[model samples]
Target chain A: MLKIEGLRAGYGAAEVLRGVSLSAEPGEITVLMGRNGAGKTTLMKAIMGLVKTSGRIELDGTDLAALPPHQVPRQGVGYVPQGRRLFAELSVAENLEMGLGAGPAQGRAATREEMLELFPRLRERLHQRAGTLSGGEQQMLATARALCLKPKLLLLDEPTEGLQPSMIGAIRQVMVTMRDRGLAVLLVEQRIEAVLELADRVSVIEMGRNAEDFSRAALSGAEGRLRARLGV
Target chain B: MDFGPYLMLAMLEGAVLAAVLALMASGLSLVFGVMRVVNVAHGEFYMLGAVVAWAVTTLLGAGPVLNFVAALIVAPLVVGAMAAAADMVILKRLNYDPERTIVATIGLLYILQQLTLMTYGADARPVVAPFNERIALPWVEWGDKGLSFYFPWGLSTTSYKLFVIAAAVVLIAALKLFMAKTRAGLIMRATQGDREMATAFGVPVERVYALVFGGGAALAALAGVLIVPIQQAHYLMGGDALLLSFIVVIIGGLGSLSGTIVAAILIGLSDGIISVFFTPTLAKMIATLAVALVLVFRPQGLFGGTSR
Candidate 1:
């Protein structure tokens, strides 16, 4: 489980996240929806210690706020940043190896065979440069790489952005599989339908603060109100 | 005097020079490629290597072979430690900003140069070679009865010079293998490819940067140690080494390993051959002119990809 309270973060002289608090539990997907520039990315980044922040970010009761970005992964937090951010020149296998370099959780990481089985297309392009992958394949590779950490809590920032419908479905299945496997997922997404289908709970972010929190079952009747709040 | 023998001798000498240049320039390129920071103080590390070698040899009071062997192992380690400390103390504090690092290294260059001068003095010092046996070189000539091998007078090289070339080749190969096959190298390459992603993956990038800075300094020091026997250790020696390394790096492509080696060979061979046949100044002039033309026409360099 991951918890954050009174999290305030921003770049120099300009605060983007103001007193936001949220929690994500195991075996569930916590979908965070927000309008453009509502600070969804900054929230994820702050949790990963990529940005300076004042807050109590706890993963299984250990503080992550004081740690550096590199140390955050060691706390069982795997981040799939926006844009995939794959090592463009590195091979897919090498990229997976890089994920392992972060010191996998419990000295255990997903093996190449496991990753290949999960994303069969990756096995065929094992030696191909990650940059050369198609948009869909790159997204899959990014998820596979994060999975290599065998992380307790995975943070995904818009994993389906710019993806085709088939690729979106594939990603949806991956998220569902992770959730069922008892992994905690904190996902920042814009796809309301996918969120309704996949998320166990939803939190809407409004202008750097948590606006609402409700069960995914409540989303069906509350779609219009949620859309009005999201301004989507 | 037959010109063929002289040309052959020039080429042998050029190869030796090329070996040393390749080691030095490759280190420079690797550091730039990984850190994206131009190390103006790199030459000072080379100078320190020679100084350390001199001190080690003198303190051990051993035979030429033993002394050289000890110095070879000790000099790079000491310089590498010093560089790592410098990286942590200064470069890291500056956050490795490109312009700030450049300025920091420039300051470090003078500081190191002055420290060496104050401690070691300004005198040029010689380090005796481990072995200096003369090997007569034979050349094949077409005679009345097919081809015959003959040793032309004065056409010979010292065993130590050949050893320097061999050592360089072996060490360079080892470095390449280490970079390609080692886990540390994988982390370094990952960091080079994408710093943010590497950090997110828990690479401890600061440690990698320190290792790389130290490794690059160690390489330059190793080259200095190997060449100190031929070229006396001097306080001002790093100036030319730095200039020549920059030339090779620029010509080969700023961050390319293979490009650095190729450019080093090209420049080193030309420097040696032209110096033998013509003048060293002319060789240098021609090299400078060539670099200018390369910059004007193909600024990315001969082997460089699109500028990083």
Candidate 2:
């Protein structure tokens, strides 16, 4: 249900996502693979309306190009940015409340409850200040906060970075459950195997242009070739 | 034969007086906390409240209870609305320029004082007690040979000054609770903590500025109401309180409510005690010097908890 056409974005003078294009369908995990500075995060931020973006960005035939950051959630976009930028001093509960915004839509708290059930460890520390939480716990809190917005498309940036294997497994299960629940996910992570394992389709980018778009099954057997391309 | 009674009486008077000063300073402190705007017109708000109460009671034939309560409630709310109007007329146009806003408010201060003088004529308008009776405080006889001290009991016990103290304590407590408990209070705190982040949260920051200014004006108005009973509701009442409130805020730590209360009490007691022994002018001079010295040593005042 998400689409991007000729998306061009940058911070200031230096252009990052140079006329890139990609899309994720309903109930599917679309993995975006790229190097450290290859504009993966830029594309996600552009979609969330957090960064300056030009060209076409739409979901279900509606443009969200000029919407403010706070309005992005109402337009069916949920973002979990790198570093899990949770409001540091606020408690997990308050942080979650903030994600709910001033809008009067129902099920915001119920969605949080569902995320807590999925990440049951968060259920215990529901009232703890987010700054006091461990790295994995903070990531979960950030992810859980975004999910509470109840968006149709979720953009996750580096969800596995600096996280333990168990947490990564939990995130994978969450993604699968959410996909089955008909929530489209645009997954950005460094873990090639984990991403490939979950994504229904994969799109690789090099220097802001799409290098390849292939089904997850096609990339499964060509692991050696991809490792050679990555030179790792 | 004993000076103990005189000293005790002086101490009691000082506390009563200090409570009045503390109330004014707390209002100034709250305004500074969130908006970071130093409202020079704060004392004018207080004076106007006192003057308005004085006039309303005397002219309308209202009793002290009704007059006093009405004064407290009406004056601040009116002044707060005036401040809100000022926001639309003047401050809103200034766009957070502290130097400009200060000049504008200080200008408003002078204009208010002048207008009050022009209308009320330079006489000290007298406000009477509810019942025309002089009650004497129980006299503490200390010396022999008919050399005795009379601490007046009747008026002193229910002095408008004491009433102001009770009101001040209640007002401050209510404000404290309102700031901590409400949703709007959360928005205010967040704005004070980090304005941009709060704005990003979709809080209208301009509304915050207006509310803060209104709150400050309301406080000054309360101080005005407190002073109406004991002091004459003269136009110049604002001047003395205004300068003193500035020193109180600085001594208390900028934008700290608790600090303002403590510092105000300290300064008021010092002002009263020093005034008893010395001329009022000299007492103010010494108090200013003392505050300067303390601030030199501890720049953030005693409670040093600024919002930032």
Candidate 3:
């Protein structure tokens, strides 16, 4: 489980996340909703310690605010940053190997082997350069790299953004499998139907503040009004 | 001299010189390839290598072979460390601007050159060839034109220049293997190609960048050391070679091994051949002008990727 209290963070001279607070319990797909420039990414960056922040960010009751962005992976928070920023010059195999870092992970290379089963296409393209991959394949590689770490909390920044319908379904299945395995997922996304149907609980973020918290049932009849406000 | 024998001798010497030039040029080009830094200080590194080799050998009372061997180890590590430090303090702050970076490194090059001169006292030192024996071929006749080829048959190549030539070729091949096969090497490739994305993936890019700078410096230094036996290790030894290396790198395409090697061989042979007919200065000028013309037509050098 990941929790934040009054998390305020921003770039120099521009504050994005102003006093935002939220929590996602185990096995919960908590989708944080907002329009463009809604501090969604800022929140994600703050959580990963990529951006400097003031306020408490705790993962399973341990303070994570002081850690570096790279250290967050060790703290069980695997962030798939926006734009699927993969190591372009490296082959797919090298990218996965780098994710493992400083040798094999926890005496088990099994995590990677398992992922190859879930995403067989990656196994086929292991020797191919990562940058040459399609958008969806690159996204899968990025997500799979994080999943390779076996993190407790997965912070996904728009996994479905710019993805084809088939790719979306594949990613959705990946999320479903993660949730079924009791993972805490902090999904920052724009898609209404997919996120609403997939997320166990929803938290709407309007201009850096938590506007609404709802269950899947609360999405009924209010979809149009929410869609209009969000311009989704 | 008969044209046939004269031409054959020129070709052999040119090949040996080409090997050394290729080694020096690869160091310069590889640094640019990985870090995109001009590394104007590269020449300083080469001078330092020769100086270090001379001093270490003298102080240790070692033989020329040991002196050459000592230089092989010391130059890269010392210069590499200095390069790493420079990157951390100077380049780290400089916003990755090509123009600024070039000026900054040119400044660095002078500082290093002056530092060494102050430490070592501006003098040229000679490094002796390791062995005494010269195994000579009795005679090699090419169509009865009387072309005699001589070398130490037991050892690979008796001439230190020829030895460096062999090492240079091997080093390049090894580097290609490292870049293509290794995981960490792949990270460097990515960093060089798309710096922003490499950082996003949590690559220790800054550290890698410094390491590469130092690695290049070290290689240049090695070249200086290798050249010591052929020429003297002077305060300005790196000056001429550095200019030639830059031309070779430009002609080779920055950061490309294949491009650099082919171009170096071409330039080295051209220089030697031209030297037979003209002064060294004119040979250099012609080589530079030749490279300039190549750039005018193919800005990326002979083999550089067209897009760059």
Candidate 4:
């Protein structure tokens, strides 16, 4: 489980996330929806400890905000940032190797083989540089790298932004599998279709604050409310 | 004397220069590649290696072979540890900001040089090579006696000089293996690719930075130890070494190890061959001009592609 309360964070002096609060429980996909510049990415960065935060960021019972950025991932958290920030110079297999170091000691081989199965394209290009991959392939590599962490909490930021439909469907299936396996999936997405398909719970943000929340039962009739709140 | 023997001699000298220069410049390139800081005190580290070698050889009072071997092992280790400490204490404090670190290293340069002067003195000192047996080289010519091979009068090289070239090749091959095969080397490459992302992935980036700084210093120190037998240790020798390394790094492309090696060879051979034909001054001028041309046309460097 991951919980953030009144989190205030941003680059030096200019706060982008102004008192935003959200929670993501295990075995659920909680999608964060917001317009551009509404601090969705800022909130994610704050969670990752990439930016300084003043409020509480707790993973399970542990205070995540108190830990350094490098230590945060060791607490069973996986992150795929806005850009597919793969180590450009490293080969595809090497990128996955990095994620393995942060993951559980048990099932190390199984985890690597499983990720390769999930993205067969990566297997074909195991020795190729990550930077040379196509946009869709790069996105697959990024998601696979994060999944290699085998985390209890996964944070993905705009993963489907530039991906093809088939790739997006593949990503949606993986998210569902992870959720079924009792992992908390906190996603930031712009596509309503994707949000509707993957979100078990939706949290909307406006001007860096929580605007509304809808459970899966309420989401069916909340489409108009969500569109109006998101202004999309 | 025939031009053939002279050219061969010049080539031999150039290989020695290139070998040492490659070791030193590779250190500079690694630091710049990973930490993104220009270490102006890199040459001082080289000087430290030579001075430390001298000190160790003198203290041990062993045979030439034993003393040289001991110095080879001791100098790099000592210099590497000192550099790692400096990285943590000084460069880390500056947050590795480019301009600030350059200035900080400049301060380090003077401090190292002055300290050596105060202790080691201003006089240049030579460390004896393990062995200096000279073997005359053969030259072939189509003279009155068709295709005759003769030993040229002055065409010879010492056994230790040959050892230096072999050592550099072995060291470079080892470095490549360490980088391409080991886990720690992978971590360093990860940090080099993206610092923030490496941190996000649970890499201890600060520690990696310190290790890289130390490793780079060790390489420079090793080069110093190798060259001390041929070029006497002097406090000011670092100035010219630093200049030549900067030229090689720029021409080879910043942060590219292969490029650095290629550029070192190009510059080193030109320096030797050109000096044989023209004045040493002219050779230096030509090298400097080459740098100017590289900067103007291929600003990204000869082997470099899109900027990082």
Candidate 5:
């Protein structure tokens, strides 16, 4: 489980996250939805210690906000950053090996074999450079790389952004599978249908602050109001 | 003198010079490649290596072979530790900002140079070679009798010079293997590829940077130790080594290991042969001209990948 309270973060004097509070629990996906520049990505980065912040961010009772970015992964937070940020020059296997360098997870991390089975396409291109992979394949590699950490909480920033419909479906299924396997996921997404289907809890962010929080059960009757609030 | 034997002798001498240059330049390249900081103080590290070697040899006062062996091992370690300390105490504090680190290293260059001048003094000191057996070089000529072999007078090299060449070759091969095969190499390459990604994956990139800086200095120091017997140790010696290293790195393409080696050989051979045939100044002038041409035509140098 992860908890963040009154998280205010930004670059220089321009603050993007203004006293936002949120939490994510195990065996569920917490989806953060907002328009462009709503600070969804900034929130994720704040949790990962990538940006300067004044907040109480705790993962399983450890103060994550006090740690440096490199120490965050060791605290059981696996991040799939915006743009997939794969080690372009490194081979697929090597990228996976780098994921292992994050130190050991609390329980055993996912093995190379399990990762290959989850993304069979990666098995065929183990020696190929990750940059040369197709967009869909690169997305798979990014997600698989994060999974390789066997993280207690996985933070993904737009895993389906710019992905094809088929690839989107594949990623959707992967998220569902992870949720069912008792892994906690904090996802920043734009797709309404995927959010409705996958998100156990939805938090709408507006202008760097949490505007509304609702469970999936509350979504059916308030679809129009939710869409209006999201400006979609 | 028969030109054939003389040419052979020139090439042999060139190989030894090339070997030492390659070691020093490769270290310079590695530091630039990984840290993206131009280490202006690199030459000072080389000078320090020689100084340490001299001090160690003097203190031990052993026979030539034992003294040289001890100095060779001890000098690099000491210089490497010093470099690591500098990285942590100074470079890290500067946050490795490109311009700031450049200025910082310039300050470091002076600090190191002056410190050595004060402690080691300004005198040029020699390190006796482990062995100095003279080997006569033979050449075969097609005389009237056909294929007559003769030992050309004044065409020979010291056994120590040949040993220097062999040692350089072995060390280079080991460096290549270490970069290609080790986990530490993997971490270093990852950091080089993307610093942010390496950190996000828990690589402890600052630590890697320190190690790389130290490693580069160690390499330069090793070259200093090997060549001290041929070229005496002095506080001022680093100036020429620094200039020559920059030339090698620039001509070979900055940050390319193979390029550094190739450029070192090219420049080293020309310097050796030209110095023997004409004047050392002429050889240096030609080299400078060649660099200017490369800069105008191929700014990336001979083997640099991408314009960076």
Candidate 6:
């Protein structure tokens, strides 16, 4: 399980995530929903240790907040940042290899062959530069690159933001697979359809603090309340 | 002497010049490509190599070939370690801010140059070539013998000069393979492409920066060692080298490796050939004019992509 308790973080003086607490259990997809500037991304960055934070971030009894950012991924965490920040100039294969590199791998990373199988579109364009790939393809590549880490906890920030319906379906399927395999998926998303389809639990953050939480069963009963909180 | 023989001689000299210049400038380009920091102390690294070579040769007091061989092995390693240390102690402290690093490296440049002058003194010192046996180059003539090859007068080069050219080609090829086929090279390219993404992906960006800075200085040092036998080592020698290398790096495009090599060859050969026809100063003027034209028309450089 991945857990964050009263996490406060931001760039320099201004704190974006203030006293927010949440948890995503194993074999479950927990989506975080909030309006713009509500600190969803800040919470994700705090979990990844990309931003300065004060609070507890623990994964499977290991204190992640104590580790450096580069060491964070080694503790069974895979991150696909908000923009699908693939190494643009590098070829698709090279980018995948980077995920499977010696620095990131902790004996459980996926092999190149396994990743190519997972994203078949990447197989044909293995040698193509990541920058030239279509929007959907880049997202797929980004997701696959993260999966190469074979993390027990996957943190995806808006993976389907600019993707097409088919691509969204493809990524949604990957999340389901990961959840079924007993990985903890902490996703920051806005699309209610994707949230309805994949979320086992939903948490809402308002102005950097946890406003509400719901399980899949509880979410159906409280749709109106959740929509009102989300302002959508 | 026939113009043909003179041109051949100039070409041979140009090739030697191109070899050394390419090695030096490629290091500069590599540093900029990976760290995005301009190392003003790069030339001082070159000078340090020559000075170290002189020290090694003088200390060994052995056969010239053996001493030269040892100097080659020691100079780059010593200089590389020094440069890496400097990166950690100085550049890292500055956070590699572009403008601050330029000023910091300029300080480092003076410190290194003055330190060398204090120890090695102001006089230029020469290191004997390992083996400078002259080999007469043959020329073809359509005279009475009908395309017979003859050893033309004043058409010969030293064996050491040939070795310099061959060594450079081999080193560059090795560097290419290292970049294209190795895991370490992939990490370097990854770090170069996106530093933040690389850090997020578990790359030790700080260590990589130090390694690149060291590697780049090592290349400049190697070039210094190579040219020391032909051109004597002096504290001020790095000034001209720095200027020429900057010109080559700019003409080739900021961080393009292939372009650096191509521009080195273009500049080195023209320097030799043009100097043969006109004065050395005029040749330099023409080269400077070329740089001006390239900058005005193609600011991104000859091979630089529109966007870095």
**Which is the leading candidate under DockQ?**
4
Give a tens-digit lDDT track for model 4, residues B1-308: 79999999998888898899999999999999889999999999999999898998999989999999999999999999999999999999999999999999999999999999999999999999999999899999999978999998999999988998899989988887888889898888899999988987899888999999999999999999999999989988888888888889999998888899899999988898888778778888988999999999998788765677
C-alpha lDDT (0 to 100) for residue B164 of candidate 1: 86
Q: Model 6: per-residue lDDT, tens digit, A1-232? A: 7878989999889989889999989999999999999999888888877889999998988988998887788787888889998999899989988887623444533467777888999999999999999999999899888888778888899999988889898999999999999999999999887788789999999989989998899887787898899899
Encode model 5's per-residue lDDT on A114-150: one tens digit a residue. Answer: 8899999999999999989999999999998888888
Top lDDT hit:
4
**DockQ score for model 3, please?**
0.28
Tens digits of per-residue lDDT for model 6, B92-116: 9998998999999999999999999
Docking class of 5: medium
Q: TM-score per model for chain B alone?
A: 0.98, 0.87, 0.90, 0.98, 0.98, 0.98
- Order the candidate numbers by DockQ, best to worst: 4, 1, 5, 6, 3, 2
Each model's lDDT comes to 0.89, 0.76, 0.79, 0.91, 0.89, 0.90
| iRMSD, all candidates | 1.1, 3.8, 3.2, 0.7, 1.0, 1.4
What's the true lDDT of residue A15 in model 1?
95
Q: Please, what are the lDDT tens digits per residue for candidate 1 over residues A1-232?
A: 7999999999988999999999999999999989999899999989888788998999998999988778899887888889999988789988888777665445444465687899999999999999899999999999988888888999999999999999999998998899898999999999778877888899988889989987878878888887888877
TM-score of chain A of 2: 0.94
Per-prediction TM-score = 0.96, 0.71, 0.87, 0.98, 0.94, 0.95
For model 5 the TM-score comes to: 0.94
lDDT for each residue of candidate 2 in B1-308, tens digit (9 for 90 to 100) = 13454454555566766777787887788777777778899998888887777767766677666766676677888888887778667887987677898999988898878988898767777666443343345665646766676664332345554555676788888878877667676667666655644543455778878988887788888777777667878888888888888888888888878888888788877776677666688879987897888679888787874334
Error of 5 at A223 (Å): 4.8
Rank ordering of all candidates by TM-score, starting from the highest: 4, 1, 6, 5, 3, 2
Over 4 Å off in model 2, which ranges? A1-232, B1-3, B97-100, B111-124, B129-157
DockQ of all predictions against the true structure, Cα-based = 0.80, 0.21, 0.28, 0.85, 0.75, 0.70
Q: Give the TM-score (vs. native) of candidate 6.
A: 0.95
Candidate 3 residue lDDT tens string, B106-195: 998889888878888788888776753543323344556566464323222355555677788887788778878886677778778766
